[model samples]
Target: MQPSEGSRIVVGVDGSPSSHAALRWADRYARGVGGAVEAVSVWDTPSSRGWSGPAIDPDFDLGQARELFERELHEVFPDGLPDGLTRHLVEGDPSEVLIRASEGAEMLVVGRRGRGGFARAVLGSVSQRCAQHAACPVVVIRQQDDPAR
Candidate 1:
């Protein structure tokens, strides 16, 4: 009476409105299909802020990324994650990160546009890249009514 590992739906979350919408949609879809949803957020130290000294610098807090990811999860699910839902915090490019996370997943869900605005006019870079490279089907959720359409 439980979904197999292959039925897992991997969603890319970046704390953006669109990404939040994708998470909600994934939750609904997973419920309908009796599957599980795993929320994934990717973060990396900017090149501009790369290591300037030893990896263990008291001045630097490595937990920042995990904190951010948890904060986003809370924002999306203030009531807490659905029963059996999972979460992950990774470090890497969004596209590469989501693509890798989708391995063996039944589906990959993403928002139409993330934090990047005009830069992702057609399709958000991460969504586009995942659609092109993901091993499973990709579902792009619209965050808002596109008045232009």
Candidate 2:
């Protein structure tokens, strides 16, 4: 089925500095365009814990994922979500969640959550994947040198 489009700008947030930057960017752009911002935090459990076998980490709780997402959002916007802004906690791979969320979005914003070394060599997997496959335009925010960030 086709995804429903809306005047919402979807941003993939992970609480990282880059992700926070992406959120700020999305908010600014959305304000300019008169669009609403949808801040999304995507997470996934260990594959080893899937139906194939018992979870390797017994302490892992699916509920914590939602809490973390909210905490991150609050940390960035301690005043609480701004007007026309909403939060979403999705359970799945980051790329998949963001891409799917973008289907009905005016645009998709993501941070280059790149880890130096091997992970970096992959070109920031989540951002790269979303940019390549998002149904709408994708903005990949990179880490910057800002004390406020």
Candidate 3:
């Protein structure tokens, strides 16, 4: 059966290995359920977060974020993006952006951890927040340890 128009799966992508895994899982799940996929990538300037760090160009950061978002999508869908896949590159907090995107979605998918500084965390802050506050059900995908790594 073909997915109805309301069947949308929102997934967060942050250029992390776990995020890639989440994207893959979201796509597969969407296909199985006849749903569409919406991939969201978020970026924020240090000043926006009130960080007292050295001045940085916001344009440059946005560009890098866009690049990473595109790269991640290409890496995941090397052959081509699926028919119902949509991409969004927004500038804001990752958690807030993803949560907002989750509205009206069938489900929200995210990586257990992202490209954050905390290495030992079982769940990244963004994913944790989304799981807690998103309007839709959330699925967190854990990154598999590669034997080669």
Candidate 4:
């Protein structure tokens, strides 16, 4: 069953366990609804974001982001990718990029927390911002082993 136009499930992937769970959940939901999944992975140079962290080459960071995105997808779909799955590797803040992608989408899905330093927080900054500002409804998937569960 081909999904109707505009029935897209946009999901954010950050190479984190919770993101992987979100990806799997998005795929399953898309399949059940005959919708398509748009997986968005965002990256930015530390300097660009004024993080003051160790300086790194933008090219290398981009390559690493791409590799991580592909690895996560492969891990989630070991056999093969789903028929209606599409991937996007964008350069920007994760929340901002994902919010932009959420426009005209059926839903936006993200993980409760990512690789950010705030691991102990219930929700990561990206996920929180996405839930607050995305153009569509948002689903925040928690990690499988989250103690809050």
Give the CA lDDT, 0 to 100, for residue 68 in model 2.
Answer: 77
Model 2 ranges off by over 4 Å: 1-6, 47-60, 114-124, 145-148
Per-candidate TM-score against the hidden true structure: 0.79, 0.78, 0.85, 0.86
Model 2, position 89, has a per-residue lDDT of: 81
Error of 2 at 62 (Å): 2.3
* lDDT by residue for model 4 (20-92), tens: 8888889888888878999999898888756777889999999998998898899888999999899999998
Whose lDDT is greatest here? 4
Q: Write the per-residue lDDT of candidate 3 for residues 11-99, one digit (tens) a residue.
A: 99999888888898988888888888999998888766556566689998899888988888998889998888999999987888999
Off by over 4 Å in 3: 1-6, 118-124, 145-149
- Screening candidate 2 with a backbone cut-off below 3 angstroms (N, C-alpha, C), the clashing residue pairs are none
Count of backbone clashes for each model? 0, 0, 0, 0
Question: lDDT of each structure?
Answer: 0.80, 0.77, 0.85, 0.86
Per-residue lDDT tens digits of candidate 2, residues 22-90?
888887778777788999886556554358545655236457777877787777778777798898887
Candidate 4, 126: how far from true, in Å? 1.5
- Compared with the true structure, model 1 gives a TM-score of 0.79
Where model 4 places Cα greater than 4 Å from the true spot, the runs are 1-6, 118-124, 145-149
Q: In model 1, what lDDT does residue 84 have?
A: 66
Clashes of 3: 0
Please report how far candidate 2 places residue 96 from its true position, in Å: 1.2
